[model samples]
Target chain A: MTVRELAALPEFEAVCLPDGEREILGGYAGDLLSWVMGRASEGDAWVTIMSNVNIVAVSTLADPACIVLSEGVAPDGDTLERAKEQGINILTTSLDTFDACVRIASAL
Target chain B: MTDKVNFHFDIDGDNFTSAGEASVRIKKLLREMGFSPDTIRRVSVAMYEGEINMVIHANGGSADVDVYGDRIEIILADKGPGIPDIDLAMQEGYSTAPDNIRSLGFGAGMGLPNMKRYTDDMRIESALGVGTTIYMTVKT
Candidate 1:
C-alpha cells in the first residue's frame, strides 16, 4: 500500500503527506532513533511516539515511506516544518505503537 | 585523494535539534550525485549516527566527507572529553548519556555499533582530556 492509502484509514490522520504516493513495504516501531535508523528498511512506515526534528533526520537517512506518530502524538513545530520541507510524509494515529504497527502491517 | 570531492561542516553543540543537519545535507548531495540507493543509505546512516554521537557525547564536532571513485570516507572529530574505554563504549546497551538525552529518544548506546554496521571500515582515535575522532569508510 502507498502512504496515501495508509493515511486514508480512519485510525490514522495525515499530518503531512508530501510524498503520499511513496510505497509502504513494511513497518517498524521504535523510539530509539539510532535503532530505527539502522533497522527500519526503506519504504517502511516508521511508528514512534517521540516526535522531534531528529526524527526527520532519521527518516531522511532511512528513507521510510512515512512516519506514523503513535498514541496521538504530534511532531513539534520544527519537526513538522522540516518534514514538509524535506518531502517526508507524516501521519498521526490514536493507537499506540504496537497497534499502529499492526494496522500498517495488515494494510501492507 | 587529490581529485576526490570533499565537504566539511562544523557541527553545533548547543542545539540538539540541529544535530544531524550535516548528514541530511550529505544525503542530498549523494542523491544529486546519482549514487546508488544502497550506497547512499549506508553512507548517510553511518554519518548520521556519528553526527548524533558528536552532539550527544562530545558537545559537538566537525564532519568531513571525502568521496572517491570507489569509496566514501567520513571523518568526525570532537574536542570534548575523550572516550576512556572504547571497548566498553562499543558494547551495545551501554550508554553514558544523561537521562535528559535518553528522554529525547536517543542514548540507547547504539550509535557506535550502528556506524560500524553501515560502513565498510571504521576506526577511532582518542586521548583523555583532549578529544576523539572517528574515521569511517563506505565503499560505493
Candidate 2:
C-alpha cells in the first residue's frame, strides 16, 4: 500500500503527506535513531514514538516511505516543519508501536 | 564532475535538532550528482552517524565531504572530550552518551558501528581531553 492509502485508514492520521504516493514495502519499529537509520529499508514504514526533529533527519537519510508516530506522539512544531520542508511523509496513531506496525504490515 | 566536489559544515553542538543537517545536505547533493542509490545511501548513512556522534559526545564538530571520481571521503573533527578507548567505543552496543541523549531516541551505542558498517573504510584518531577525528571512505 502507498503512504496515502495507509494514512486514509482510520487508525492512522496524516500529519504531513508530502510524499504520500510512495509505496510502503515493509515496516520497521524502533525508537533508536541510529538503529533505524542503519536497518530500515528504503520505502519501509518506520514506526517510532520519537517525535523529535532528529526523526525527520533520519527519515531523510533512510528514505522511509513515511514515519509512523505511535502512541499518539505527535511531532513538535520544529519537527513538523522540517518534515514538510524535507518532503518526508509523517503519520500519527493512538496505537502503540507494535499495533501500528501490525496495521501497516497487514495493509502491505 | 571533473574536479573534486567538497562540502563543509560546522556542526552546532548545542542543538540536537540540527545535528543531521550536514548529512541531509550531502545526501541531496549526492542525489543531484547522479550517484548510484547504494553509493549515496552508504555515504549519507555513514556521515549521518558521524554527525550524530559529534553532537552527542563532542558538543559539536566539523564535517567535510570530498566527492572524488572513485570514492567519497568524509572527515569529522570534534573538540569535545575524546574517546579514551576507540575499541570500546566501536563496539556495537557500547555508547557513552548520557541518559538525556538516550531520551532523545539515540545513544543506543550503535553510532560508530553503523558508520563502519555502511562505509567501505573507516579510521579514527582521538586524544584524551583533546578531541576525535574520524575518516571514512565509501567507494562509488
Candidate 3:
C-alpha cells in the first residue's frame, strides 16, 4: 500500500510535510540502528522515535521508502530541512513506537 | 586484472549519534561504483553493525573496506576489553553493554550475529585485555 493509504489508517497520525509523496509498505520498528540496518528492507516503512539527523543517514543507508516518527516526537529543524533536501518522506504521530508499528503492520 | 577499491574510516567511540557515518559513506560509495542494490545493502548493514559494536563496546575502532571484482571485505579492529568467549558472544541475545547503552536502543546482542547473517565469511581474532579484529566478506 502507498504511504498515503497508511497515513489514512486510524492508528496513524499524519504529520507529513506538504511535499512528501506517500509510497511503499511493510513496517520495521526498532531504535537499534545496527539491527534495523540488517533487517529493514527497501520499500519498507520505518517507525522510529529517533529524532536526529543521523537517523536520516541511517534511513538513507537502509533505503526505506518512508520514515514514521512515533511517540509524539518531532524532528529537529535541521533534520526536517535535510529530509526535504533528501526527498525522504517524513511522518509524525502521537502513538507510542510499538503501537505505531502494530498499526502499520495491520495496515499492511 | 586488479579491480579493487580501498576505503578506510576511523570510527568515533564517543559520539553515539554519529556512529553510523562511515557505513553511510560506504553505502554511497558502493552505489556510485555501480554495485547491485542487494550487494550495497548487505555491505552497508554488516559494516554498520560492526561500527556500532566498535563505538558501544570497544570505545571506537578502525574500519577498512576492500572492494574487489568478486567480493567486498570489511575489517574492524578495536582495543576494547576483548570477548572472553567467542561462542557465547556470537549468540543472538548476549551482550556486555551497560544499561545506558541499552537505553539508546543497542546492546541487543545482535551485532555479531547480524554481521554473520549478511556476510559470506566472518572471522574473529580476539584476546582478553588485548584487542579484537573482525574480518567479514560479502560476495558480489
Model 1 TM-score? 0.97
Candidate 2: where are CA atoms >4 Å away? B1-3
| Candidate 1 chain A: worst-modelled 10 consecutive residues by lDDT | A98-107
B13-75, model 3: which lDDT tens digit per residue?
A: 998767888998898899998999999988988888889888888899999999988999999
| Residue B127 lDDT (model 2) | 96
TM-score of chain B of 2: 0.96
Ranking by DockQ: 2, 1, 3
Give the worst 10-residue stretch by lDDT in candidate 3 chain B. Answer: B99-108
lDDT (10s digit) by residue, model 1, range A13-102? 999999999999888899999899988999889999999888998998899999999998989999999999999999999998888888
Model 1: residues with Cα > 4 Å off, grouped in runs: none
Return model 3's CA RMSD, one decimal.
Answer: 2.9
Against the native chain B, each candidate's TM-score is 0.97, 0.96, 0.97
Q: Considering every candidate listed, which one attains the maximal DockQ?
A: 2
- In candidate 2, position A18 carries an lDDT of 91
lDDT of 3 at B11: 95
List TM-score per model, in order: 0.97, 0.97, 0.85
The local lDDT score (0 to 100) that residue A73 gets in candidate 2 is 94
Residue by residue across B45-90, what tens digits does model 1's lDDT show? 8888888888887888899999998899999999989999999999
Better of 1 and 3 by DockQ: 1
> Candidate 1 vs candidate 3: which has greater TM-score?
1
Q: Which prediction has more favorable DockQ, 2 or 3?
A: 2
Compose the digit string of candidate 2's lDDT tens values, residues A37-104. 88999989999999988899999999999999999898989999999999999999999888888888
